[model samples]
Target: MSDLDASTPRIFLARHGETEWTKNGRYTGTTDLELTHHGIKQVKGTAIQLVGPGKLIDPGRIAHIWVSPRKRALQTFSLLFNNSSSSIGDGTTIAKTKVTITEDIAEWDYGDYEGLLVGEIRAGRKKRGLDSETAWNIWRDGCEGGESAEQVTERLDRLISEIREIQEPYMNGGNAVDVVLVAHGLILRAFAKRWLNYPIDSPLPLMFSPGAIGILSYKNHDIDEPGFYLGMALPLQD
Candidate 1:
């Protein structure tokens, strides 16, 4: 019999490396782009920081790792774990882990303005009589070529439920391990919002830079059970 615990799981979320589009301040929604050299190095640094002191992450306990279906994200995941590859060194304890490619975890789909910048989108929205604020915050207003805020919430909610299932053993203490998620900016922010049980309408001003990580601790709420709180954003700078 397999006993899965969903009571207390700490989800470690990371935003994938920076892409050319992201460097240009363009909306990278669904548009796949490769990460810059600097971006690649940035994510590698995050891996180093995790194993450092003051942080309680046990590399061996990371049982599962997840990344978006995009090439950039996949590449970042590979590089981050490349040191663990048995082919790389004579003898190194490369933590055995499984990387899962998740599709629903993709960034917000920016329908028509897929490659356009936020400024450009705002200008267009204004010409079309849409409120500038609304246009700027398409996530809140559900703009012309993008997903509505509610839709984003629904998608993230479903993803979170699945993530909990994936890390069920860890959550229930069946597996003394951690789960790593390599996703995008908005997706990570959405996870934060859901983790804190924040209002659905709250604007997500928290920007996750390339290689930034956010942690969330989940606990079943009960009369005698105390909830847990995870730490805030810890940026992995160059």
Candidate 2:
């Protein structure tokens, strides 16, 4: 952004709000679902508090936006931008950036485990002897019919490359330039890892909550340096 101190291009990763499955601790993907009422309210509040003139994220600074094809993710994006209107409270307007539905940022395709809870999946695997001493983890074992962590990493890396190609110049273009991605929890966490050039096999320090917001930027206004974790907006309790 023009007002920002550095030329580092900032990325805003907005995790989609809560869904029925998420509320119940299920692995939701592929089977598109809508946000819960509280989820809608969460994202709307996030919008009003973070995006606007002179806010934490200036709407005018956004240059590109990518949203998941899933309905929940799209709904979250809608709620984020629909915080207000003419003569409304706070009057936060949506960014003019074109929103693209990207498969790259879509939730990790949970496939066979789409509607199953983690505990259930693990118990099933243990029952079938598919798992032994270790509990099931998507980052490594992945779903039987779903994408692996390596596959997810590949896709996210490609997306990051493209984002850099498009936003690098804009970052140095001497004007406001930030990118926004609205997607699911796991995928966005994977994205954060890849954004920081971390190996997919590494343990992630944090898990994103539904309707969470995290930022990624260069450590020193230089892309060659490691990416920095700026901060998050409205972090949910574990």
Candidate 3:
């Protein structure tokens, strides 16, 4: 068995590939969009680099996959597992991995700010006599008429609890059991913060690029000590 299998379980957070809105810097919450041609290639490349036997994300070890309800995230999941014939692994790993489409991992609801760029949002807020002196910060001010940081924290905390429950059993020496979350950029960043017990409203320097993957795991193989992986070596093949 690989050393990773004997260590703490991990959560693989995958951001969906680029869309026209994403590339153009628009807030994409609740506005379901498809991936562009380039986006498809990006995810396929990530799969080749990360998802396979003896790779960072060996799909056979993934216990559960929580995907956003949006089509973009769904497309990413399909491409990552080679369901679209992108050909990363043998294509049988997904069949054994449990996948769920959930709103819990969806992007932060941008509401009135949906489809608008950051500058546009700020201008609109100023026109409406909101935040006239200060610029708009989604993490602190949140989107107008949309969810707040506290609300996002509530939902994410609940989902984190669920993920912990799933991983607790196999955390100690056993078969590798990991969880995968396919979602949007902002929310995934927020999720990472929450995983480390950090407030979502805090200054977040985390940057999750399009089609990027981030790993979260317990430190020192202790479930009580959650931490993010800055870098990890590949598991040794038996």
TM-score of each: 0.77, 0.87, 0.92
After superposition of all CA atoms, the RMSD between model 3 and the true structure is 2.4
* Span of ten consecutive residues with least summed lDDT in model 1: 221-230
Candidate 2: residue 9 lDDT (0-100):
73
Candidate 3 ranges beyond 4 A from true positions: 1-6, 84-91, 235-238
- How much does candidate 3 score in TM-score? 0.92
Give the CA lDDT, 0 to 100, for residue 194 in model 2.
85
Candidate 2 C-alpha lDDT tens digits along 60-173 = 667778999999998987777665331145564554446788899999998788899888888888888987777888888878889888889989999999888776665455
Structural RMSD, model 1: 6.0
TM-score rank, highest first?
A: 3, 2, 1
Question: Sorted by lDDT, highest first, which candidate order results?
Answer: 3, 2, 1
Error of 2 at 97 (Å): 6.2
Task: Please give, for residues 104-132, the per-residue lDDT of candidate 1 as tens digits.
Answer: 67777788788888889888878888784
lDDT of every model, 2 decimals? 0.66, 0.77, 0.86
Could you say which candidate leads in lDDT? 3
Pairs that collide, model 3? none
